[model samples]
Target: MSDTTTVGPDTAGIGRTRTPTPFRRLLAVETRKLFDTRSGKIMTAVMVVLTVGAIAGRGLYAGPRLEVLIGTAGLSLGTLLPVLGILTVTGEWSHRTALTTFTLEPRRGRVLAAKCLPPLIAAVAASAFAILVAVPVTAAVSAVRHVPADWDLTPVALLGWTAANVLVVAMGLALGMLLLNAPAAIVICLSAPALWSAVARIGSVGETLAGWLDLNTTAGPLMEGHMTGGDVARLAASVSFWIVVPLATGTARVIRKEIG
Candidate 1:
């Protein structure tokens, strides 16, 4: 009354083992995932468009000051870069691919760590892009204005700029991982700076909290190449709050969360 099929060697191999995916490959895949979805593509396109637009707008309106030109693009990059990091970390959960991802690479920590590299790399790349674009824009504007461009940029300043972007992106990644929800994480990521700014204007306590915790203030002197011993202490405190806490909690959650 029933049909049955018996499978042998050709049908299955019970003792087969497969090589694990390399960490490098995991990083590569994560990078590709950045452009694999609609939101990702749109965000990426917007970042490119805005960066170029900011550089062009500043170059046309103001004289060619290298720091000013780089800072112009940083204004947009500072906001959007974290958003990109948020999307990168949350995309898996938002798209419901976490199960499959964890199934393939059971070491969730490695996967998560690999996921973070792209954003950090993008940070460095973005700063470099801004600097490179500034060079051409600086030359063009200087030629037009017939004035020498400011070549006062130092290696410390460049490192500080890149570090600040990386820190912001890391905050995004940490928040995204901690929340595991794209919309909520993005909203918080965007709202947080505004909230801190408003609070910083409240009173002495607010100023003290912001001075220690708000990256906007802590990172300012560093970007301006005037980082001092006190700035270092403030920057360290800000980094601990913005990056370490969320990332630590998020990693723990990812390690133990059961996938359906």
Candidate 2:
């Protein structure tokens, strides 16, 4: 027998490093996490229920005008998507999973990117789904009530509606990232519009500032597809202040903060 034993193939590769996860995989994981948690699942369910109820209510009582149906569904989705975004970012901290997440990924910016992408996609999907559901319901209501089924939604209006919902979702993500605490993030996200509305009522100067800085006001024209050049300018300014600034600040903070 030989005095020395030969090294095995498995042992020879022991020092080899594993590959980092691809961005696509990261996005998929983040998307799945949105629905995997108990709270995520519950919130999603509530959103769906509210959307269906709103559409159905419109069909039954109010005229199932396509615009009204879209607006109602959009409102429900807008209300809930932010909560979903907040929980998505904060849940890692709340559940003490940040340590593991950072350990595995080691790049906080990529993690944040992963977290942000899902909500935007979800918002677009939810908006489309609402439109799809409304079509059949509107037809049924029109037939029963002998009203014309107005399928007169223009491309611009549809695009604007989707864009408005996406902006709201982005706002929620920005707020969530900025606060990093679920309750505080959620409260601020919900109350900021109302607070700004109060501020806007103070004076002409306040109104002018709000017109440019308040997303609730600036984004309203988008839903109606009636944005003028001024409306577009105001929307841009408001999004820059609310979404861009906070996201930049939050990304820096998250990158620097030590994971416990």
Candidate 3:
């Protein structure tokens, strides 16, 4: 045997190694994490329960006032979807599985995009489910309670609302990445709307500004068939704030940050 071991080329150390099936592999892994967690399961259950409860409540309790019934449906949509959005992103951070996620997909942007895909799919499904539940439930409730539960189901408005929700889920994912703490992100998502409403109570300018910033206020147009120019502007701005800004910031951070 030779006393000295044969040496490989030192140049081999200088080249970059590449992941073979990076995005595809990362997408699967990220999606699996969503289904595997207790938090994700709990959130899913809560979503189903809340959804069914909204249907039942609307069917049983909605009285003669069509506006009240419509308001109830809209509010229910607002509450449940945002909660779903919050959980979609925050679960990973809450479980400390971000380590495994980031580790597997060292390219954080790709990982974030992967994480977003499942929730976007869920949002579409949830939107259609909401409409399905609302229609039959409203019909039954209107008949039994002797209430006029009437509204036009504009396909364009429905599509807009569905897209809005998908964007909301994306926003939640971005918030999660930006905060890296589940509870904080949840609190922010929950409180921000309430805070905007409170500020809206102050004065005219404050109210106007709040209407611009408050998702609750902005959501009215999309929920209804109004779709006025101002409403469209506010909705656009709100979507941009949550979906665009946070995503850009989070992607930048994830790209540059040191991973463990």
Candidate 4:
């Protein structure tokens, strides 16, 4: 040590920095987590079974018109998909994994984005699955009923159905993130529409507001693939209230709230 005191060789850089986990890796983990739990697996199985059963039932009675088949499956999926999204978020807290998750990925927003994307993907897949199932069912029903199979679903109708499912799942994710409690999130998500429907039926003023802000009314046309410009405007308003506000507020809370 002639000129300078000996220092540890570049130790400053060794422990001071860590490469952040890749976003794609985080997304893959989140996607797997969606089906890794017992409840999650059960819920997924139930959704698939119900979708198949609903389509089959319609084939038996209503003669599996493509619209009827898709509509029936969409109804079942719309209800269940949201529940799936809700569980994806609430389970992190319920299972006491949020602390670890935040520790591994300090940026909570990325985590939330990761959580949101998979459900939307699932929603799209569910719609596609329904369509696949409908094809054979439509064929069988047309044969049995001695009627022409109506595979006349336009691209617009298909797009609308897919969008509707995604919106419902988004609403669920927003509510789950906002509440961070599975029971509360599920309850509110289920009841709010009914409550709004009741309020909408009360008076003309209420009806007018609901016409714009009620997702049930606005999103209904999407399933039928008959959205007008007015319907699009109303859907945007309803989604802003139900999905955007809650998701934004919930994300902010998650970012700042103390993790236990």
In model 2, what lDDT does residue 174 have? 88
Clashes per model (N, Cα, C within 3 A): 0, 0, 0, 0
Residue 162 displacement (Å), model 1: 0.8
Question: Pick by TM-score: which candidate is best?
Answer: 4
Q: Which has the greatest lDDT?
A: 4
Q: TM-scores of the models, in the given order?
A: 0.92, 0.92, 0.80, 0.93
Local distance difference test, candidate 3: 0.69
Q: State candidate 1's TM-score.
A: 0.92
What's model 2's TM-score? 0.92
Model 1 misplacement above 4 A: 1-18
Write candidate 4's Cα lDDT for 76-106 as tens digits: 8878899999999888899999999999999
Model 3 per-residue lDDT tens digits across residues 1-260: 76998888787657677645567777787667666777667776777667767667766765434334434544555555555655656665566676876675666667677777877787788767767767777777778877676765566767767766666567677777777666787677767777888898899998988878666578677766578898889987876777678878877876786645
Off by over 4 Å in 3: 1-19, 63-77, 142-151
lDDT of each: 0.89, 0.88, 0.69, 0.90
> How well does candidate 2 score on lDDT at residue 84?
89
Ranking by lDDT: 4, 1, 2, 3
Tens-place lDDT digits, model 2, residues 216-260: 889988877898999999999999998999989888988999886
